[model samples]
Target: MADKQLMTYEVGEQMNLMALLKNVTVRVAKNGKQYLDLTFEDQSGEISGKFWDASAADIDRFQAGRVVRLAGKRETYQGSPQVRIAGLRLANADEPHQPGDFVVHAPMKASDMEEQINQVVFEITNQVWNRIVRFLLAKHRKAFFSYPAAKHNHHAFEGGLAFHTLSILRLAHSVVQQYSSIDAPLLYAGAILHDLGKVIELSGPVSTQYTVEGNLLGHISIVDGEIVSACNELKFDLNSENVVLLRHMILAHHGLMEYGSPVRPRLLEAEVLHQLDELDASIMMMTTAVEKTSPGEFGERLFAMDGRSFYRPNEPQAGGPAVK
Candidate 1:
């Protein structure tokens, strides 16, 4: 068997390796010299690198998504490891590298996640909601499974959208079981379609960025519009109360107007959807932060979490004495 490729390398390590060129940009230094700022990645993780005093010819030769051989010294910048590239060139055809080895992916298998999500759709007994959810899922199944939840926030990896949606669906199922009054169909639909618009909102799975529609309308409005289009195609009544409620859930899933929800969640189902969405996103953010930090130390401040840092304890602690 071939030796295992490293997911990450240590700082101060001088090495030559093959990795995907995830991103590249050119910028001028203070001395009027140009440099290439690049991000390289393998299944392990991503790292930034700077090719100082790069020539125009060099820039022309490098492009994103291509596998390349890189020789560099790893160094630290602001507590993160980065590379100072000494040399770089496209990998030879004979090089034992596979594109799949360089990309990050969700922990769960994509096919398994898709199957589980389909099972949830099958459970939605409400005909109208069930049809709408199935239509949207079928229409965007490719992008839905391929795109990240965000460019660089929670669930920002391949298959993230489905992973995030499935996570929320699981949470909503428990919430509905606990609160019998909650509408199961609406909540399930909301969980699956809350971020459906992100398929068009994000550029793609690799080195993603916001598209024109994403930047102008955002995912909330984009999916709201999608609901209208889907309703038209399906010949569903536009003015039906069920349609309005579902649309409202998507519009108000952001929960607060300040957070970009055009309208606040007014219905009970909408409110629950918003809360569950927040719960899933917050948990992912916190877990990601904690995992990145060393045990017994505080993590870097998370700007999205109100700039609060999290602590990762070295030892697991049991719950305090149970109340009598």
Candidate 2:
């Protein structure tokens, strides 16, 4: 994309713009001067800049999640676009915009997403699975619907955790219908609860960061423990086949040990859950990349996709969807 149409700029020129401080960090320069590494974002996208010789007060005021009025010039450094900060200050209360006006949000409304996912909950037919899913959903209701699935990755915006889950649920429904031997209830429950641990693993949506427990134990372990606790609280037999199978779905959803799964999926449903989980996340990441890529060119490298960049076609391709 052209630097003029870059992310937040409404005009095709460098000028003062209201941008959200997506991230801010203090660093020591080689000259022993303190500087601020800043990331600014709007509904469109993000740009990083540096504020050299930052005061302690500047560090305190230019925090993540705050809206700022900034004058920056779009510049290229080492083959990547960067913002050269001229001046910036926190947006005043009298300003028309606020923090939320610049933050990226899920395409779907939170209430609508909630209602649609609730409809999928009905498809979970197994009584044991149904009970645990409902209980856990209720327990982490707000965060599950509001938190991003990860600090940075596919679906890393507001309500992303729920949106990503819903996408998997939709894909799983088609898979179950196509393959009758597949346990519909098991797959549905697994999709709904697969990343619910993110509510505890990641902090709230804005300027997200991992918690101490999230860093040490990770979401996979955190959620497995949650399932075990839920079973105990529900007075359900923790050793029962149903509980074991349900837990296995979450436990092995990451697929392999290296990816974070404690055990490889031995059951058919568990295997399907892992595949669909990966599929939904991959699609979201690619979709976002394709949207940004200019015609007949490759987008930026996706670290999650093994540092690969996808090509955007100038004309409609015969076999696939076109970049929008």
Model 2 poorest ten-residue lDDT run: 2-11
The candidate scoring highest on TM-score is 2
For model 2, the stretches where C-alpha displacement exceeds 4 angstroms are 1-12, 28-34, 75-81, 315-324
Instruction: Give every collision pair in model 2.
Output: none
lDDT of 1 by residue, 1-324 (tens): 442333345557785888888788899999999988888877766777888888888888787777889888877564445788888988898984565567779889889999999999988888888899999999999999878898776888888899999999999888888999998998898889999999999988776778999999999999989889999999999899989989999999998899989999999999999998888889988887676555666866778899888887775547654222
> What TM-score goes with each of the models?
0.87, 0.89
lDDT of model 1, residue 282: 90
- lDDT score, candidate 1: 0.84
Candidate lDDT (C-alpha), each = 0.84, 0.84
lDDT of 1 at 66: 76
lDDT of 2 by residue, 140-184 (tens): 999998888887769988899999998898898899889999989
